[model samples]
Target: MRSLTVVGPSRVEWREAPSPELQEDTDVLVRPIASATCDLDRRLVLGDSPFKPPYALGHEAVGEVVATGDAPCGLRPGDRVVIPWHISCGTCAECGRSMPGACRSVHRLASYGNTAGGHWGGLFDELVRVPWGARNLVALPPDVDPVVAAFCSDSLVDAYRTVSPPLAAQPGATVLVVGGTASLGLLTVLSAVALAATEVFYVDRNPRSVQTAARLGATAMLITSYSEPVSGVFDLTVDASADTEGLRRALKSTRPGGTCVSRSVYFTEPALPYLDLYASGVTLVTGPPHATPHMPEVLRLLSSGALDPRPVLAGPYSYDEAPEVLRDPPPGKPAFAHPRAGAA
Candidate 1:
């Protein structure tokens, strides 16, 4: 088996590694049929991430279950499933509360690409070991394309979780997505539109990203200057860009009693205007997305053929080209496809 390893900043290579096996009765072995790069991965490659190198470097994947343990409820060998980025023991207290991403029993931040939660390896490998299969894996419907479903492991699911709950809390709310033309920002735009926000405003300087947002039903605006006052009209704002300006804009964009959600994983010290936020009476929320809880609803939307992630999929590459693809993503979601392999 080969896995994509990030040796250092702007350095990535494919290394032959031992294939993963089912180490526990609840574990399942999967062959990645399709895998995509997360926007955060670009930051990791540029040495902008807090996570160090010499580890597997992918987290989003859709794959075929090659083998499963005897204990199972909905999955089987040959079933196409979406693997969540985080490795969680579903029976933990946090997982029981429908917050598997914050499960205390599992290693904190136990993700496939990072070493934070123990090295479970990355999805950019030929084989992956999924622990707690019954609770974490979401079987993709036959009709959904593996390329589109690949994002369900992270971005799509994250988008769904970010928008749906907050929107449900406040129907017909105006939402603002503060970020660049990156995948996370774009997905946030799409999610806002899909959830039927009264108005979806995307802030970014890149014309390409702004164009992408416009095509996806968002009012794209170029951020020429940070000093300009953010139009404080939104009920909810999602800051996928973890920069200081992005955060400030998100806080300022929301109404006095509005909520702001930060989805970006910031590795640096983001200078925040605490006094301004306090004065505005803003409610700030930020965390890793609970993808396990949102996967079902995301899949349902994909199955219904109402949601199209193709706009977000910038490119699709061969499995052998994983190293180069991560180094320089073409544009949007760069998905790796294996023709011989089953749908991921």
Candidate 2:
């Protein structure tokens, strides 16, 4: 088997590695059919992040189950499933509360590619070992394509989780998404639209990203200058852009008592205005998305054919080309397909 290994910043190679097997009775082995890069992975690859190198490199994937331990009859060897980025024991206290990203017991819960929690190995490999399969793996609907469903593993689900909770509490409220063409940002746009927000405004300096947002159903604008206060304040603002200034603008653009949700994984110290935030009475919440909690709902929406993520896919390439593609993805989701390796 071959796995994509990151030897250093801006360095990656496809190297021979052992094929994963069930390490425990509660574990399962999956072969990814389609996998895509997370924006965080891009940051790690560019050396702009704190994540160290010499680790397996991907986390988002959709695949078919190749084998299972003493898990449950619900999943089988041939079943197609969407693998979540985080490994969690479904019964844990945190998971029970719909916060699997903060699962307490798992020491360094592994994601597919990076070594944030532990070296789960990258989904960019031939095989992946999933622990607590019964609880973590979500069966994909027959109608959903593995390429599209792969985004659900992280970006899509994260966007849904980030926007839905706050927006649900305040129905028909305005929502603002702050970010450029990042997958998380785009998904935020999609989620906001699907949730029927009174209005979805996207702020980004990248013309391409802003255009993409508008096509995805948001009123896209460039935040060239913030001198004048933004009009039509929002009830909820999501800062998916890893920009500190953008986040500050999001906080300022939000209405009083509005919630600001930040999904950016800032690897470095970003300047913030605490006093301003305090004075505005804004609520700030930020963290790695608890994607598992929103997986079922996102799947339902994708399967309904109402929200299409196809436009978000920039291009597709063979699994062998993943290393180079990750180094320089053109735009949108660059899907990696390995039919022989099975669906992830």
Candidate 3:
């Protein structure tokens, strides 16, 4: 089998790798039918990330079950499923509490597609192993396109976490999304609009993203600076911007008692405006996306046509093009179409 390996900054190549097999009674083997690059994956390929090279290069994918263990799971051979980026035993205490991303049974930060996690092969591989199959795989609806499954694994789910819960808490709330992080901010805007927010405001230096946000029904603004807040306060503000200044702007733009959620990862410790937070009573939420618990709902939205994320998909490139496309990826998310889909 061949897997995409990140050999260095702005470099990737297909390397011969071991084909995965079902190692446990509960384990399953899958062939990626479609895989997409997350914002972090883009950084990794561009050599802009903190993680070093020599690791498998993908995490988000929708795959076909090529083989299943003897254990009775909801899935079987030929089933198309969404593979979560994180690895966890579905029956763990943390998972039982709806925090599968932090499952105590696996190594801390255990996941596919990154060196920080254990050596689970990347989704870009020709074959991959999925442990705890019953708990980790979500069956995709027959009506949904396989390409959409690419984002369902992580990017879309991460954006869902940023907006869905907050909107549920504050119905028809106004939203402000700062989108320097990449596709997340645009997806966040889309999610907010789908959930019926009174108004959605998007700020990004990239005119392309701003234009996309407008198409998604957001009042998009192209800003020259991340240092200053967007025009008005909102019921919910998201710091999808990976920059510190953008995070600060999102925090300061949150209305009194409003909530601000940041979906971007910060490598360096950033200072916050304590006095402003104290006076405004702002609630700030930040952490890795707990996507497992929300995967079902995300699927439900797609199935019911309540959410349409297709606008953000950049390409449906063939598997052979994964290397070059990932190296110089276009603006939106890029998904690769694997050769085998329903192989026995």
- lDDT, each prediction: 0.83, 0.81, 0.87
Model 3, stretches more than 4 Å misplaced?
A: 339-344
lDDT of candidate 3? 0.87
Which model scores highest in TM-score?
3
Q: What order do candidates take by TM-score, descending?
A: 3, 1, 2
Better of 1 and 2 by lDDT: 1
Candidate 2 runs further than 4 Å off:
225-229, 340-344
- Candidate 2 residue-wise lDDT, 131-164, digit = tens: 8988888988888878888888888888888888
Which of 1 and 2 is the better model by TM-score? 1
Q: List candidate 1 segments past 4 Å from native.
A: 341-344
Given candidate 3, what's the lDDT at residue 114?
86
Residue 140, candidate 1: how far off, in angstroms?
0.9
lDDT of 1 by residue, 87-187 (tens): 89889889998888888877888888888788899998889999988888888788888878889888888877788888899887898888763788888
Compute the lDDT of residue 299 as modeled in candidate 2.
87
